[model samples]
Target: MTISESPHEEEPLVASIDVGTTSSRVILFNKLGQEVSKHQIEYSTSASKQKFASGGARRFSVDSAGGGSAGSAGSAGSGAASPSAARQAQQPIFSAEGIAIEANEFLEIEDLERPTNPTLTFPRPGWVECDPVAILAHVVQCFAANLITMDKINGDRVSRSLLPYRVRCVGIANMRETTLVWSKATGKPIVDYGIVWNDTRTTGIVTEKRNSTPQALQDSLRAKTGLPLYSTYFSCSKLRWLLDNEPAVSEAYEQGDLMFGTVDVWLLYHLTANHAFVSDVTNASRTGFMNLDTLDYDDELLKYWNISRDKINLPKIVSSSQYYGDFTVPQCIKPNLTSVAWTLLTDFCSRSPPVPIQGCLGDQSASLVGQMAFKPGAAKCTYGTGCFLLYNTGTKKLISSHGALTTFGYWFPHLENPEHSQPHFALEGSVAVAGAVVQWLRDNLRLIPKAEDIGPLASRVADSGGVVFVPAFSGLFAPYWDASARATIMGMSQHTTASHLARAAVEGVCFQARAILKAMSSDAAGEGQKDRDFLEEVVDETYEKSPLSVLAVDGGMSKSKEVMQIQADILGPCVKVRTSTTSECTALGAAIAAAMAYEKREDRVLWEDLKDVKKWIRYGGVEQGAKSQDGSAPSKSCTYKSQSLDTDRRRKWRLWEAAIDRCKGWMDIVEEGTGAASNSAVKSM
Candidate 1:
């Protein structure tokens, strides 16, 4: 891929602050994928219990002994207060020594306006959510942290080792479908709680559309939108849910006061002080509102949804790599405590032509860009909390039949040539839970001593010993959107050891990944695009012809060599695990996007060329660079090949599928147990 040189590159740095569901990260990249400097901080989500309670009890009333104005006073205290204020009220006020908690804990006047804890929570089943205002606060905090970290490590020895050492521009890549209705006037989220992708409350709306719209019409919409009618991950479903259920949102929609967007657009508007309410084509495509063919919202779609184009402010869909806006440190983040001289110096130093946020794509779309799977039929599986596989389908649309999603690959700007008008597409498949099972094993069950220990423990046993763990924790997604499903560990016996369970958990993730790939292949076959032979060829070509293919795995789980080997073994031969030792792929991907946008390199070279891959080490349990530290070639590349275990694997896979069937019928049992317990509690009360 094209790497921008110092002489040809533009001035100022681009920055990307990725605000994820679980944590927040800030990254800086030059014109090359090389990371300049980066910082990561984990933010806690509101507890599950709080969210369930909040969503259940929608009424604002929390009665007090004194009625009348007391209720009004309580309402005013909670409603008039900012999110920051609400959070501050929850924090315990301490004395100088921090020994005693104050009885009447009063928030300081200065702290009243800012929330001490601005986090998201899932208040109920089928309702994954967040506080939109809190998300903005976290964004500001992450940016400040990046700057501070870079300043502290500017001259440090560690900084020099990690980066070639220049920070120029910043670009933000975010979660695609998490959406909100915000007001342009006050710059506050119109919705108190942000609806995230996992929220299935919109099922009713999606079902209605599927039932009313003709099959041909729905197919046409799917072909044009690069999305499936069954998808609840897009904003279309969430938007429909709000419009149907929330009267306020519907009223706002009628008055033309509503602004709708993915997190990227929401962030762009807020970052630029509401001057620009736009998103790149990558984010737009996933909305289901945007037509994949036109790369704009379809008139029919808007009409069907009963959303007036004039009423809803839609962002201009731009290329993934382009200048969006400049970063003017918000006044909220400015250090008011510092002297005027220091404040002026800081402001002057930070100010630069908005570090060309040259690259902007949804996190998954960006992963495709980052993986460098530019050619059609080329695929990559990103093993993270979730497993997502994207097969590049070039410019053609391939509607999925086997649960695979059709999504936008990238949007190249129409420079001078009219031929480059439309955005490219990819066949995308997502596995909701992958490495998350490992986290559950670590945190919830304490199956392993530590998170990383899972690898070593699983290594003790070569395989899962017939134990199949279907980690349908929050229900199965992609290929099967079974919302009622929960986790199931079947084929267990007295002989099952901790190691067996651990191995099964890892294998379960691999099974899901394979399931998605199987579905995508099946869908393509059904579409008459290609059959299993073509798909096998795709995998074969990826390994034999492509530069790298041992699943370029990243994320916290990628650090586990044992896990990688298991992933390879299950997928069969010629599988190569190509990645760096560090779990820095997300940051690396962000850096790459920023580089591509700012440098404005040859679109083909930047996207399709093999030069972007600086390292493609084979997957080995041992921690060693695919290449030597001296920048020399490796002695050999590791390849995983299956040996006469097809029958066994197929048997295990069938067992896994069977386990899902059993889990499907489990809701009744769960409800019965919960019902009996609730009855007992009521009697006690």
Candidate 2:
């Protein structure tokens, strides 16, 4: 079955709430993991651009590293400004230096500290933020909207069935590392807006931690937690930044009224009426304070960050697929939660029981699960506002030798032991900008009317014509891990045209993804050889074959046939690409977790084994010259079969590599008010 096709028959459904960078969406899935119904609500818009400015989509692709998307180029930071103000704020200059904006020129920020509505604002260069209130409101609105959508689609299946009872369970997947805090008593946001995952505002904090601490301690930070201290990309630093910068938050912390969490904790608190104060293992792992081995907040690590215990309320860590709790219908609705909308959600739930939101995952990890990468060797990439490639290492906790990160893939404690119920670890490589680069072409450069126009625009020219664009916009993630690098467009000549520039930008994303895949493969090979000295049977996954052998893909930008084809050609080697044509794998993964929770609660088995999940999901792949286990033709899918030669791939890589050298170290970024960057051994790539 296709994404547009859904069965209206009597079938139980699970729901997933996807909180991305640009929008919040809800999707209902049957047991087959096919979308039954869904609804999406985009967050806010940014200021318009001049003829040579940037994208109007208001994307914030920071080093904040959203769980799934481009910072998730998402977040509910939707604020519409005056036309004049929008035009005035943008000061686009084509300088001899290749940067889009001068460092001083980007200081024309508006009063985006607080917003009454859904508004996305950029307070500084390389920073993206959203109003916390708007974040919750949009999420609830998506849920409410999905309720209406399901009823209309379900038809006779629902005989006056209240929304709470329409679905058995729900799951939530959101951008990772996007930090939020609120008053525990009033349930109101603490800061003016929540710090988006990609916001690099906390870069100063990262520099301080790495510099002040002894070299030995700095080295062990990654040993204890499979993450490197790159920039302000996690929750702990953002929380600390708030405590120091926002006096109100510091006062609240002292007064014992502060509650800090990622987007997951914020949503769970509101959804369950502030009852479910829990963060799943996946979300908790993203916070720098969480110990990767213990899967809980570490006191020493917290002390390193100066996070006091028994002062602020942190969410209790839980399994990714456990029954956290059931949602509670709020008795009173605020302006954010309207009476009519709440009424649309449930009166039946208020009278009886609310729907159980049992599954939770970070966006990228959820995409892995949604793609059914249950095996350790499997991997998937999400080409959202930011692109993330997560390689499943099963129970093996293989850390990246390259700049890539090691993280908890997913933890399904509800599943039987036969499926290996421990938390899965992964090696992750992230490109801070993907689709946002395209948005730059649309809203800023005005090269095209829509984001999709890049495909046709690129096809206008046979190739990039030797032009190369390296978008190190938010520094670089994954193997390079360079934080000082700014964007650079190299190789442009007198012969270059708009089509050449457009195609080069598209190729930039593909090349970045390729770099990550190569790094992941290198790491996997090293781990396989090293771990064999201590362990056995660890060679079955990526170590046994090539890393990223079968990359399951999803996200907003993955829909482009041109983009996928470019990715295949650049990949060069023989690889099978399974594109999630539905582009909702992140939501599907969350729903699957919810389904697992529901099944465990009812003592029923959804699949004979967890490995069979991909088959039930509405996925059919088209493989060229490939046969099934039973020697039958492979299932049909929107897959790309590449005839890319090694020489061509190398040439593209060399072009990108040259541009990267020119772009790196363009900015000497330092955290404000804490210390100078000179004191630290920070690599500002």
Candidate 3:
């Protein structure tokens, strides 16, 4: 039941399943902190109409958003509608800001818009989604496949021959902030089929609340609610949208029968056969419905949305790694059983004493843990579809000034006792596009034959040749929250090639990340010295207990050595760029949480210290790289000096700033043209 004591004796198996926006994976880790066995299964997103053709020629869509037609899901214009209403539509087609497009010209983006292989479809203009059924089916498939894969890998022959190599506990790390409310009575999702994270349908509800509520009162609500009242991305807006749109949900709220929670809560509910309706603190932090001070649901938030208590099924706020419920396969996957799986499940079920749930943090939180940025100011940037950075702020409630969010850090195992400060806080900033930009190149531009080729190709030239690409494929997010900006590639000339575009794409991502870091520093109340102070503080505390000197990087995209070095060159002055040995930082974070929870520790030491990393670098006096006037690379790129490089990057940022401004008004033009076309439709009728 427990991890074996011997060094070579395999640790008790702990399963970490990552349910990401793009795919699902289950990894089984051994005692040495390495993967023992694993299985990954990819699922498809809803097709877009614009890319679909009956002809066999299979031409890829060049649209920034996914497949759909010009007016379909992946449309270029940001649609107009209330925030709450638009949030539910699931399109990532907003403008430069994180806000949703207006309803009149909905940008129909496909969920899966890669270049190599693509699916095409266009539903009605307003319909966007990830069919709940497909999600459920995928989870089931991953679970079953992982178990089956484990059985095949550790069959009877291996079990008898090598007892050290077996699997043990199972835990899930999921995409937080994505919520769905469904009925418990019928065991079905209550809302429309395609409620995806990027949908911004609930803008109106959020705006109404902001406009109606007094400023002081609203601020109090945010402080009490422990969440911002900005857009429809959070749970409050989604809840409001359901009440406004769906009569059944509205009635359930009235009758006290509406149940809602994020993806993890829903999955656990079904996984445990309704025995567990608990959400770990980290996931709950994202709902904007939880009281930051109390770590409990805010009654006032529910009241503001006019949702009655009895009708909604809510998850209990609990520590990340505690016994949520016993693992029992859902009824649907039960029949297709194997003996090894049966044995494994039976072993897990028979615990005479209840096994404590060891660790539970949101996927982002887990990545923070996995990166070992334990100390205050130590940070990590996770490059997925988007880039999210979390700066551990110890226990302080550092409010954001530059659009960064203040969120609960990981709730350590020891914090479960009432006497402890259960949740730590962090200054968080999220950029909506990162690796997705590379994906855009692969899927949208058809510039790269394979995604992995981007790094080397980008590194071929020292700079991006004055090309600056804002992967505002969806509107911008964090620091500069412009909702109406479209993806724009500026500074292009006759000689500009796809290689320049590729390099610019990477730099654009780094620039966005820099923006997040800048905002987080300002939020921490470290005004003028925010950037430098953060670096120095992190480096000093983490490395030699001196000023901070470098940044630790991880995630799938970190595999690009050129990108990491470029990041280092840009950051300069002991800015160490370190990547993890394993690409599964998120998974590692989950395991660490599970381990800490099992051991009942206050905090587990991080994997890498910023101070220690500072010592490893040999160059201290080198000049940092300079940014050209066009936001392209300078002739000599890798020079690392604090004074020279900092000045130019700041100057280059102005170009980035101006480019954002130039692209901001594009949506109106698209909308007007579309409006005329729509009038023609009416006139024809």
Q: What RMSD does each model have against the real structure?
A: 9.9, 8.7, 11.5
- Candidate 2: tens digits of C-alpha lDDT, residues 1-685: 0112122323557889888775577777776666766645443333321111354222221211111111111121122233322443453321111112211111121212123333465667767787666556556555665565565565644555632225767799998998888899887887778888888888778877777888788768887778886566778888888899999999999999999999899888877844798999888988988888888888988888888988899999998887776765443333443444466566535633456778999999999888778887788988877889998888878777767788988988766774457888888989988877876776568787556677778878867999899878788887787777888898889999999999899899888887887777767767646562322333444422454566777876677787788777777655666787456789988987776663343333334336545555643332335565777654434787665777877887888888887777767633332245444535553
Q: Give the TM-score (vs. native) of candidate 1.
A: 0.76
lDDT of 1 by residue, 637-681 (tens): 233445427676667777877877887746647778999999999
TM-score of each: 0.76, 0.81, 0.76
Worst 10 residues of 1 by lDDT: 61-70
Off by over 4 Å in 3: 1-10, 48-128, 155-161, 192-194, 208-214, 225-227, 335-358, 415-421, 525-548, 599-644, 665-685
Candidate 2 vs candidate 3: the lDDT winner is 2
lDDT of 1 at 267: 76
Model 2 misplaced regions, further than 4 Å: 1-10, 46-115, 158-165, 331-340, 351-353, 528-545, 598-609, 619-636, 669-685
What is candidate 2's TM-score against the reference?
Answer: 0.81
Candidate 3 lDDT over residue span 1-685, tens digit each: 3333442444256667676654455676654346665544333233322324332111232222322211121121112333422432543332111112222222223233334232211243322344444455445544544555555556764667875444444567877877677777766777645345565666557767777888888778767654567655577777677778889888876776677888778777776633577888888988877887888887887787776666677889987765566565565543333444445445545554433334567888878776767666677778776888787876666667577777866776443343223466777777777877776776667787555677888988767777888888666777676555678999999989878988888888877776776666555545334433433434222212323344556765676777766665555554455665456778767766565553433222211122221211111212224344566542221222232275666566777777777777576578888999999999999
